[model samples]
Target: MTQDLFDPFAPVPETPAKSGNTPEFSVSDLSNALKNTVEDAFSFVRVRGEISGFKRASSGHMYLALKDDKAVLDGVCWRGQAGKLGLVPEDGMEVIVTGRLTTFPGRSKYQIVIETMEVAGEGALLKLLEERKKKLAGEGLFDADRKKPIPFLPDVIGIVTSPTGAVIRDIMHRLRDRFPRRVLLWPVLVQGNGAAEQVAEAVRGFNDLLPYGHIPRPDVLIVARGGGSLEDLWAFNEEVVARAVAESDIPVISAVGHETDTTLIDFVSDLRAPTPTGAAEKAVPVRGDLIGQIEENGLRLSQAVRRLGVEKKTALESLARGLGDPKRMLEERNQMLDNWADRLPRSAVNVVSQARARLNETSARLVSPREQLSEKRGRLENAAVRLDGAMKSALQMQQARLDRASAGLRPSDAKRDVDRAGKQIMDLGARMGAAVKNTLTREAEGLARYDRLLESYSYRNVLKRGFAVVRDGAGNLVEKSADIVTGQGYDLEMGDGVTRVTAGDATTEPASTPTAPTSGGARDGDDMPVDAVASSKPETVSKPKAVKKKDPQPKDDDRQGSLL
Candidate 1:
């Protein structure tokens, strides 16, 4: 007997056949045969081992190896079955998988095709739960600060639980007995496959409802379940359900299982209740007690207000008594006023008598106005006579001096001086006229030179040389052929006149015939046609007549003569 060295468990080969009776098999045929044999033999199995090399592919397929102290077995769970496995598979986690054994033809190896997988036992499940709790706690999901305060009295209370269970009924009955509220029941599976997902979705669904929508959104959420074993209540222990509770916008009251039954959700929820009934009680207060307290407070407030009003009235009355009588004071003031009025008229008559006597005495001591004026006129006549005598003496002295001075002069001397002044005036006027004539002549010559220079620089001189200035219809100078637009009108300015033309095909006729220069006598420089000058014979060309320059001589007119 010989065993294959590569595979210790492989079947041993029998003795060599004498004839060619041994059947030959290809690699694929052998692999398929082994796959069929392994599937048929272990069609259903449950394997218990520690997970190793666990990896989830991007395609959602999970690949891993299960190993014990002695040997290792490879396993694979397709995407469809992986989600239903309840717990996430991790490295070093002890698990139990149920599936069929199959062989891979390409690799020529045997593996288990897992359908369902779970933590191996209660102890293993507890270990996995503890590890998950530590991970979520590290991320602050279980912190007290992250938990929201539950509403004391919610208008709408949303509950997530199985519809057919007795747990929901107990909660509803308790709420009705205490303070009846509007309840929104979100039906979900409590335990089994997909139970965790349903519970998580129910929590998120209530939060998604709009506050002002047709259906009233709940103010608080209650997640309740009945008492059960650890395995039976495993759904609440799921990490997904715990995260959903932690992230809830509304406060949550966890009432899953009994008082002693703890799960991941209990640690994350805002509040925890021992039972479903307890959760309902925590949701709202008793209506009767609230009403009784309010009435008691109102009674106390009214009594305090009444007592304050009595104290204020007593204070006001005491202050009024301290004031004295107002009528007595007014009577005393009236008596004093009558005494002063009786004495005032007698004092006025005495003052008038004294003033009249003083006026009579002053008149007796003064002189009359008519007598004083007569004395002043007499003094004025005396001064006028003395002044007339002095004036006549001064006039006689002045007249004697004038007669002595006239005796030393002669009329011939006076006449000679007058004639000499008249001759000097005539000579000055003649010299002034000559100077003005010279200045006028120089100014006129300068003006004529400027006129000639301006004519030399004028464009008309170029026209006299047989050139014409062209301009567009808009009157802009056309210096280049590129500036001319086809089919546009143009003007040709010659020395004589401006002629209009149109730019068209090369063979097109002019728009208007240029008018022939008038056949009159030779014109002056200002109006002569340059074309006629250029066409004439050189010998017959007459020099342009000189422009008459204006004399700048000053004009004589009736005006004021110079004082000099």
Candidate 2:
């Protein structure tokens, strides 16, 4: 297979042998050599082509093929550089990329590592702007349903434009002449690099202002700028600025330039005022015109009221004329009143007679106040006398009972009771003392017995009674003859001390008088003489046999002594 120049794994081109020897190169060395050469030659090159296969990866790096009608070149913009381009690359966009040419060894291809990309000219910028416009329009930012109605007379007006430009002056002067309102001016750059971001941020900042904050929120917004060329006015055409205007909670008036100027923001805003001055006019009604209209309305209302009142008065007079003369009507009313007056005194006399009869009958039915008081007084006296007699009887009974109870509770009787209680207390104290003593004695006897039991089981006591403990070569207690190997050394601990000795075979002759060992001093691993074994029969070995030498174990100085 043919090797590509940029591939790191590609085989190096072979060189013809010169006198049976030629310089050598590795695949990686050749790839590096080619990469350096191309990078050095095109370190600061600029190429113009139409962008194709454009995409931004999740890592923010932008990749595209910069192609013409006949050829194509691979291009890449790193994340940082791509962000600073100020324009998102799209298919068919003609752009000029300035960067160094570099080879990707793994891919076996060369690509331009772009540091910056820009539209080739105004045409390319317009194409890019148009693509972006379509995208945002598809998202419904420019829909009429998203548009908010501008306030007819807002309490406060917020203007977003360059603070030092004529846009602000025109907007402010127009507002003052028309109708003065509180103006909140947000200062921002209207052109050049990062202008779109600043303008979008300004729009969001105004919207973020709290409705009841220390700084009052604007009732309506006026995004204005002075006249400029398409490049100078590109900030307003940015999708960021357009979307910002679309999402603003307050109504927005887009006034970017002269009457002929247009931008994406103009379509997205709630109202498109042709100029900054027009925006101000749209934000508020003219003060003089409003006052004039008010006066005209007032005049019309007053004239209508006068016409209505005059018509109603004329109608009333016509109705009054239809009635009879006033003097004859008054004479008839006077005659009727005189007749009523003549009958009123006789009716009053009859009512007075009826009321007098009712009073007399009521007076006969009701008892006199003096008689009622006299009866209540008689009842009170009877109750008082009965109460006095009852009190006397109660006092006599209480005194007799108290005397009887006191007669039994005398000083002598109190002494007798106290003496009896003292005798009982003495007896109880003596019996309690005897019981506590007996309990202590029984507990002491039990404790003594437990102490004796513990002492009887003590290792020292058992050792003192002519016994020795044997630990095998593994330092474990030898509980059976099977646990001991005949030739293995073991530790023998007695009441006085421990000694190392080898186990003797379990063979024995008839019991004979004890004698000294036949071997010299019974060296470790030496078998004890058959006459010394106390048993008669030899034990058969069942377990696997191993003879291990035991290391010397240190013992406390007090525990190191010969057995008596």
Candidate 3:
């Protein structure tokens, strides 16, 4: 029994085999068969699923996996078809794809060859839009600080919209109504199939225009389109379009769809208009209103200037009132000139007398020329005697030295030394004479200056300027009005001659003040005759009151007065 136990590796006895009819297939042939079957069965199908593992190849083909929770079906969108699909497919996007089912023999896999694709529903489109917004916002593309300010008045306006749509017509009509401006139309597809790419390219093209070239660069850009559904307006919401709007150097005004409709470009643009017409309104101001405002401002400025002039004139008039009468001021200045004139003659006489006294004193201190010459002659005689004695002694010493040095001494050298000494003496005498002449000339110039100064200080100059001196009976100056006594005789010293006149009684009180009337005379403020007033005070003479004088020719109020 142990020997008969299982032999695991032993060969078993063979039996005759019978075969039935069945089909055989290679890997290539089987894969081809299945592909054809799938193509025929689901040739035109719309499959709804969330996209996964989405990839765009360099060959311009898109490969993606369409997946629900339970299963995934591979899908491919050729380059030509992918662009026709309005929206780009992204991972996690719920989409409906219309295509034929096919199999790849190389990988032995089945896939959907996508002809067209779209967001599965409104909810899916909104979700995709929101997700993309969040992603771009996180990158700071929607930041308010990144947005440029719109120009109040743009020179050239660039519009990106469909060429034949009512949106452009509406914008142009609105602009014409408000203000006329140069409009550059960058025609683009506003919706469907490659619309987003066209919009992006149009924006970039407008920005690329040279500012000072054949084409004028736009100061502002308007991306406008008519009202439509979210899907129809999705071209403006694409990330490519949004990014182009954000990076534009010119300010962008987004006006897409209706007022309630929103897009990603609207967030990144400098301004968002509710409608295409609204965008035009934002681009320029009402011309008539601007002209009216300018005219109003000009009127206001003129009024302000006139008012300022009136105020300054009033201020000047008030200041002029504070200044005393100009005639009285001139009289006072003339009196001052008279006083200066009276002192000038005396000052000049004193200066001349002092200078003359100094000259006499200096002359008294000087020695006589004859005595000076005699003293100098005695000194010269003494010097000559000393020289004679010194010369004799020096000659004796030289004779002793000559006995030893005459062997090498030259008579020609001695003669040359003597000639040089004589030449030096002549030069010194000439210089001394020139120095004395210069000193005399300087002293004469100084004397001339003093003489001119004395003449300048003379009172005759003051008299020539129409000033006169007033002196009392005692020949003392009556320098002020208070110094003149009633019935006193005084001398008026003019430049040519002097006249004597008795001073009349002077008024002590101001003209504006009232004085008590004399006994049996008219009361104050009474306009009585001058002769009658004099007759009333027969014993005592009454001086006329000094009235404040008014300007005879008043200055024009419009003329600017001198500050001085």
The candidate scoring highest on lDDT is: 3
What are the clashing pairs of model 1? none
Report the lDDT tens digits of candidate 1 across residue range 21-42: 5545556655766776688778
* Model 3: per-residue Cα lDDT at residue 297: 100
Query: Candidate 3's error at 238, in angstroms?
Result: 1.0
Model 3 CA lDDT for position 282: 92
Best by TM-score: 1
The local distance difference test score of each candidate is 0.77, 0.77, 0.79
Estimate, for each residue in 151-252, the C-alpha lDDT of model 3 and write its tens digit. 888889999999997999999999998889999999999998899999999999999999966999999999999999988999988999999999999999
Which window of 10 residues has the lowest lDDT sum in candidate 2? 509-518
The estimated TM-scores of all candidates read: 0.53, 0.50, 0.53
Ranking by TM-score: 1, 3, 2
Which residue pairs in model 2 clash with each other?
none
* RMSD in Å for all candidates: 21.3, 31.4, 49.7
